[model samples]
Target: MSRTVVFIHGLWIHSVAWQPWQELFAGKGYETHAPGWPGDKDTVAETRLHSEGAGVGVDEITDSYAKFIAGLDSPPIVVGHSFGGLIAQKLLDAGLATAAVAISPAPIKGIKILPLSLLRSSFPVLSRPGNRNKVVPLTEKQFAYGFGNALPPAESAELYERIAIPSPGRPLFEASSANFTKNAPTAVDTTRAGRGPLLLLAADEDHTVPAAVVAAAYRLYASSRARTDIIKYDDRGHSAAFDHGWRQLADDSLAWLDRQSL
Candidate 1:
């Protein structure tokens, strides 16, 4: 059977953004699907009109995907971006995926250092405690700084108009307090020795999930006997998953999968 691949998108961007990546993997002889998070509408415009994902938290999103995978023919390779990246890691740790790629994943429990830029990128939601139960939307200016900092102004604006949507604030709040919370939703098994190979991708210019944050996450896996690797993309931002340079990142992931013989 052809190996299956699942694409998971992080906050703000819609799952439809993974269309290109899905097609790319399919052309490579892999079955692919990019399902939206629970409560996500069928399209970007519809999702924006009604924030159905409001109040959804980290664990809920992870469990939703986990359930989806359980029904699949086999545990598929997972490719996730932003918060989706964190989910990818969780799935790999739980032995629900054959291999995984996390691009600019949100910080998990045990990540101590919080970069200034990360704080600023998250401030929109974390600025208000009540946001934990509300859906929050980023302004164009905010999106420009957080997700599209490395793109040209027009390109960034265009992407914002196309895919940006209100996202549940609870995940951001959960990740923010992960370092101090017990049984936090953002927690992941960093030391699982028998998990499948995992790849962490970071973009140097990403203000949302700084490359240093990803580096810190990679260090957390030092105790794992399983394969864990990280790659940094120069002059890219969190949008590297959908930006002009996304193909390079996607191809690199495929290359890593090949190397791992997955």
Candidate 2:
């Protein structure tokens, strides 16, 4: 049978962020889906309005996604970025997905060393602890600086317009100060029998996730029974997935996935 694929978006981004990625995989014959997290609304306008008006926390969002996955009949090849990456790891640890790809995943338990880019990307949230309890939406300028710095102004603006949303402030807080342990909350149990393949794709110029930080996360999951691969995209920037010629990244992933027996 054909395998299923699931896309999990990072902080402040909804499942729609993966439409291009999903469509690419679909052309290659993988059924793909990206579920909306709890309190996450459709469109940039709705999410921005919601954040300014109400609040959604990390636990609430993750729990909502967990239920969504529990209902799926087929185990998917899950891919996630940033906070979504954290959730992807959790699902993999729980044996929910067949294989997983975590891109620029946030810092979790067992993921030590705070990359400066992570800190930079999160400056809007961690500028002060008080900000955590509040809903923080990125101002257009803020989005430009945090996520669009490496890309062209036009490309940055397009991305910002299409997907920028007010994300849970608490997730960033949690990542910042994880009470990390060997079997910590952020730790993924990759050794599960049913777990398939796992790839940790790091971008060398990715000031957002950084090569070293992703390297650490890869090492943590390398202990899995599932074969683990860490591939570095040198000269690729933080906006690697959305930048011009984004197909290169997608193409590379497809090549890697094809070689796997799973």
Candidate 3:
């Protein structure tokens, strides 16, 4: 049977963001799929114009991607970034993936550490309680501070223009309230017996999901019988997946996946 890999993008970006990763994995003889969140458009420009992604919540996004995974011939090696990372973990817990890699994942239920940078980065969405049902677009300054701080100004500006889009506030709200809410979509079933091995990848310079947050998440998963590990990049930021060193990150993940025999 042919092995498959599925890539999931985080908030403010579309499936197109994973195109390079898809091509790289495809070159390695793995069939790759990068599915967008429901109502996402093909291009950032179109998605920005439509802002349809803002209407959906985390549950809706996860359900939509779960359905796509179910149609696959075999459970895939799932890889995701930021919010997508949380979704990948959810899918793995649901037994939809053979193995999973979550890079700079959003805070899941039970992950209590929140760095000041993360709080600042998320303020645009969380500051406005009324934004739960509204679309929130990040300003260039916010994007630079949150995701592009590690990159050169020119490259950061280019990336901001190319990949940034409006994101729904509902998911952030759900994640924030997850600890108090029973069975929140942001909650992970870490103890699920058949769940696949998971890798929590982090970037030390990431303003959003900082190393501290990733370490706390790893501790939460440590109680599970399922295999879990972590990899941290000291020089990278939250946007490491799209930064100049992306190929190195991709190659490292491929090596890790090979060890799992996926």
- Taking all chains together, each candidate's TM-score versus the true structure is 0.98, 0.89, 0.97
Q: Assess the local accuracy of residue 184 in candidate 2 as a C-alpha lDDT between 0 and 100.
A: 41
Give Cα-based local distance difference scores for all models: 0.92, 0.73, 0.88
lDDT top scorer? 1
Among these predictions, the greatest TM-score belongs to: 1
Q: Give a tens-digit lDDT track for model 2, residues 1-262.
A: 3368878887766567788888999999988888776666666677777644234554565666667777788777788887777787777767777777777777657667776777887898889787776777777777776677777888888887888787767677766667543334455564555676777777777766778988887777666666888888877765677667568777877888888887
Backbone clashes in model 1, listed as residue pairs: none
Cα shift from native, residue 172, model 2 (Å): 0.9
lDDT of residue 165 for candidate 2: 81
**lDDT (10s digit) by residue, model 1, range 213-238:** 99999999999999999999899998
Could you tell me the lDDT of residue 46 within candidate 2? 77
Instruction: After superposing candidate 3 on the true structure, give the runs of residues whose Cα lies further than 4 Å from its correct spot.
Output: none
Rank order by lDDT, top first?
1, 3, 2
For model 1, the run of ten residues with the poorest summed lDDT: 1-10
